[model samples]
Target: SGKVRAIVDDKGQQLKEAGPSMPVEVLGLGGVPSAGDNLTVVENEQRAREVAKYRQELATEKRTALAPTNFDTMFNTLSSNVIEFPVVVKADVQGSVEAIVNALHNLSNDDIKVRVLNGGVGAITESDVLLAGGSKAPIIGFNVRPNAKARELLKRDNVRMMYYDVIYHLTDAIAKEMIGELGPERIEHVVGRAQVKEVFKSGKRDKAAGLLVEEGVIRKGLFARLTRADVIVSATKIASLRRFKDDVDEVRAGLECGVVLEDTNDIKPGDQLEVFSVEERERTL
Candidate 1:
């Protein structure tokens, strides 16, 4: 019988069946195979080459399809002003990892967002550290931590590692960090406007300007902007607001008022005054 230890063609081979010598032509896969195991019964050398070629083609196509294109994503990200905290997640349990990732992905907005770079179940390893470093992302591991080698690399690369024993703490810390990164958006609102009717000197060089409230009411302690022909000449606060020598809370339009800018008396007749204040809005990711 021909040796079957190595891959061999069944055609033109000798076999002993029922103690009778015969030339084997029929092929049979003699052993059971599992799902991923290949059972190749080639009839000749040419057939083996054809099978090898087909597998190579499949591998090449798969590689081409899976390769990533990140240039455009990166360019747009760099140009825009969005707070994106790129993060890599690891956990000890599959369920924990899935739950944490789901919770994180739900937090989103146009100005701020969390970009998960990679995620998996397992203790944090050296490969995880390397991937985080390459992506400029921090590693967040839940109920897990880095190995000795991974810790060394993390220190050398100056990568931030945040590990938490409790799942709530992990999510909370990340949320806080995202909020901090989001910061606050500033909205400038113009409250009122006035024109300096006359400049009157009061204390030493300090002068209180007689004003006519042109648009909105100018209130006491409101921020004041002294402008000449749309150019900001001075920015100050309303130190004193009065009418007819009596301190008043506010003066309405078409009313003559006395307005004193805090710590400044640089008032000139015909200068436009814009009363405005900047308000902050808390943003989220």
Candidate 2:
């Protein structure tokens, strides 16, 4: 009799009493053998390619699933006007500090101010808590724990300390605070009205206007207005100005700058033009 060998199928099931000379045929029992399986060279390589493809797809899916749902979630949550509550981040790890900073910087609005109370290597100590005390900013520690004294001080001062080993959670917390503190926001300051004294056309879509700085200063990148008897009639800006065509910074109370008011629908020699500057302010929380 020939030698007997034990064979395992693709599912790792044992096939007993198989002899080498017994006309044995080994096929993929379940699906296919892995590329690294010590079977046939061709099957091994084929399985390897399939395995590699599967691994790549799985990795891609995992990354996609983990990606942030809203790019502006942090910004929308953190950008608020309420300055009463400040958020302080204290990190002993350079990487952690940077990650937090980057997330804050990338957030949507710059209104929510973030102060880094203390950042360095080592555990959170009394000094860090003291720095954050007056600001009323919540302290964030990364991969660091407070000592007994620090803990006691935190309790005495009623300071809030948040610890995190994961960066996403920290960012999420900040965003949540922002939203909770600041309510829904809307853009309000738009369209300021300034009176125009004189208008001169220089080129296409360009005009130089000599005007009294009326209700608001004529700022660049804002709409211009020309009004008659408190009613807006002509709205425009001095596209180009001169002591004879020299560019200036701004047209203030008595000075003037080159303005380029594109549209000329409601403009008159005696009408006052009001330029509205639109600005957004945080009002909730």
Candidate 3:
């Protein structure tokens, strides 16, 4: 689909032909071929068309082999809770297109994934706009603007379009979009850890653990978990913290204290206790 319009040498001089291993920039490629793709010259336009068609067939076959369309995949996708953010990408050259696609894929996480419908080189065309509209995907143009027909289609379809000359800006914007789709994330921070040194009866029916503060400060009312043999046994909170006979708010590391767990009385000697806090923070890609 592309004709070789010109070849420019490194010095910015136009050349009729380039020799093997002689560096040059080729122009007029219909689409940017992937890196390391061979560029062969054909004798005539008809022969060029034949080779292009053959390559297209091979590429399609490879794609099908990698991911085949099937009912199981469809059902799994329909049943899954993962959010997919489909997008179309267009860049000025082959290298830029590859870079952008890789960067976008790396942004995928447990919450959402960036699904690129199509990525190509050159000005965004009407076909690209149509695909984006059908998929409800936004079009990302890097150093390239849409053609007149594409612009009209984009407006008519009410499709979103984003243009960027810098890769950082493009990724940053896409990351923000992903965060918007997934909302904030909850994160847990371990504030203190302790080990049960002994177990004793509390009041008449309750039990408390004598613990030696090991890492951080164990504070009353903090969420905690009890572990035995490296396995989590119970998720509970510190109902009460006592140093000797006096009630205390917290017991710091290297100290011994009595801790009564809320709703949990199965703690035994040598068990591990971890106290933590939870917070909601903005997610990032």
Candidate 4:
């Protein structure tokens, strides 16, 4: 709650009161008002305090409702494959905070996700530093500086601090960080395709398939998938390749060879085997 000390016209003349659409300056605000906030004159100071307390309670309830509380839910996050990068954000204005938070959220993908613990306008405070310290999350400030108490706590707790004035730089840096955490990307390339002509018993408990190389080339010890009616049955590797009881390393297109797949026994004639290899490449955002 704040008291109106004086209302002055644009020419520095004191005014008894001001009306809508009048050019005047209002003095004695308790806090810096955010853009689009309503300036309403309440009945009394006590009523203003009551409204402020109620709004504070509502904000607290919203925060508590968004937080994870159950043990199962907490443990699930710890055991998940997706990596989470938590951060606290502070900006010079509310609009800047919203833009930064939205940009960070948009960078999330299947491999990694960004979690903003808290976002607020104005300078970073001690409470924000404490929250970041508790969560082990870094603090990102956009066109805003931390207070002396917050700086002291950040140094004492060894928290990471990032300051940026440009929005794109902040987003690009975060994307690169996520890519680094996820490591390289794997790409699969199909090397060969072969159709099974016959299935016969190779040993007492093992079965082998006679494959006719339909395209490319099939090599022994390469990864392959067994497909029936265009549906994948199992993924197996070529254990052995033979032609007329003679061991062969590979068979080119338009050739017939017997192949024993490792750890797979569901072999059938007229099935298809797709041979492929994997390559690792640097990941990008």
Candidate 5:
């Protein structure tokens, strides 16, 4: 006779027969079998239950061993408002790191200030956390994450790690910690727009652009964005914004002016310029 399996119900009564070649649809009955029904092939269902119960008990005991131990709790003696906030900053890109570092540094004051222990561009690594641990600084990341080992170390050491997707939010949160009150939300408001009408060559090394202010007022020393068609070409600071042959502070909408972009001279006609400024309230958290 070929091998076969007897299907049993919760009452331990045979319901049907199944082929042994396919194995039983279920193994080791647990608790009370119900109407949905399960077919088990084990000859000793009681023994399987014993093993599962032992594993569950072991797991519970292990969990009980891992008690609370975070960095915040370990460093309860650290004083507040008496020292500068030492921070280690990391981001996905160099420009982002620079921007975030600058924003954080701008939040320092007489009462409490920001002191960046270190700054870098990359996924936060184990070494970074170790560095921060030595310096007793909190690690702040922008558009990045801690590596596997770093995460483990942070949990084990109770190191503070804060991550954010937006630079504005990241800066605001850190600012509030230093200022002791939640300040205003930072906003980027557009100031002016200009269309490049022509490119001018001044010297072998110097170059400038002739622009027509299309909207708002284009001011000197403001940040600018150069766009071609509908795509962004560059985002840089205005080295010099001039009108006529002399340097002027600003030009109103619909006026023609000259612009010198820092570190770039590939200005061309049909390029659009956008100027914006960062505005915010005066509070902190």
Candidate 6:
């Protein structure tokens, strides 16, 4: 709807009704909209644009959130099937050592032992290399420059030296080492084995006996000897054993356990008992 108005002169005479002697002004007849009245529509359009933009941003964020983490790729690159020795990380700086230690501490498996052979703030010297050489561990230099001599030594020893400005890469390398493929056990041997020293009975009748774990770990389901000066008294399956009040399936050297021999009562003190386990292996010939 539009409103109409007549044009008026300065003396208040309408243009249509003014005589020829009086001047008149002509004016257009519609009501024009104010800026304030149009602002609402503009605001609504702006809000719609903002909402669309926010939705697009949300979608982008969702895609990023669903993406796989770097750690997953690192695990895939590093994980191994066979058991491996712990990776020894030798760093030139204390901060690098701490970073490696923290990374190792956060890992899932407790089998990997990350030891810092040389952790100090300074240039990599021959001494540091020698220290790493002692352990035959890998060296990681962080922010510290490695001299030519150290590099030559590392090359000569075939030692792996990794340099990193970021801690995450160092951590990733360690993770990769942890996850790298491992070969099947090629050699096996009893590293250390010993015979039992003495067996003492608690009661006069000798129902249970205190046996010293003198050999390699006395596993629960392994063969054990009960000897009395070259005489075989009894062969027992470790029925129930406790190490320092905690029940364990095996006891290592310098440990003691109470054992119940099977089908034998001839155990005597000073009898040298031997505990051994048969190691089964498959040779890849």
Best by the TM-score measure: 4
**Residue pairs whose backbone atoms clash in candidate 3:** none
Clashing residue pairs found in predicted model 1: none
lDDT of 3 by residue, 129-177 (tens): 8878988999999999999999999999999999999998999999999
Q: Give one digit per residue, the lDDT tens place, for model 1 in 192-258.
A: 8999989988888789999999988898887878998888888898888999989999888889899
TM-score of every candidate relative to the true structure: 0.53, 0.37, 0.52, 0.68, 0.39, 0.32
Winner of 3 and 6 under lDDT:
3
Clashing pairs in 6: 78-179, 78-180, 79-179
Candidate 2 accuracy as lDDT? 0.59
Clash number for each model: 0, 27, 0, 0, 9, 3
Relative to the true structure, candidate 4 reaches a TM of 0.68
Sort all candidates by TM-score, best to worst: 4, 1, 3, 5, 2, 6
lDDT tens digits, residue span 1-285, model 4: 577889999999999899989988789766556676667789887888788668645654574353457988888767778887888899988889889999999999877889888777878888788888887888999999999999999899998899999999999998888888888998989999999999999899889999999999999988999999999999999999998889999999999999999999998888999999888998876
Tens digit of per-residue lDDT, candidate 5, span 111-151: 56677766767788786787678767789988789989999
RMSD (Cα, Å) for all candidates, in order, is 11.7, 18.2, 8.0, 5.9, 19.5, 25.5
lDDT of 2 by residue, 134-246 (tens): 66777888888888998999999988898988888887877778766665565645434445567776566555556666554666655555557888555555453344366
Best by lDDT: 3
TM-score for predicted model 5 compared with the true structure: 0.39
Best-to-worst ranking by lDDT: 3, 4, 1, 5, 2, 6
Task: In model 6, state the lDDT of residue 84.
Answer: 32
lDDT of 3: 0.90
> Model 3: runs farther than 4 Å from truth?
1-87, 93-117, 125-137, 146-159, 171-191, 197-216, 221-223, 244-247, 253-256, 260-266, 276-285
lDDT of 6 by residue, 1-285 (tens): 122247698887666554555655445422222223221112354565565456545643562242446987667547633333333344555556667667655753534434444344556666556656766667677776667898788777777677877878877766666555332334434322335445555456545566676656666655666666688777665555666667777777777776655556666667665665556443221
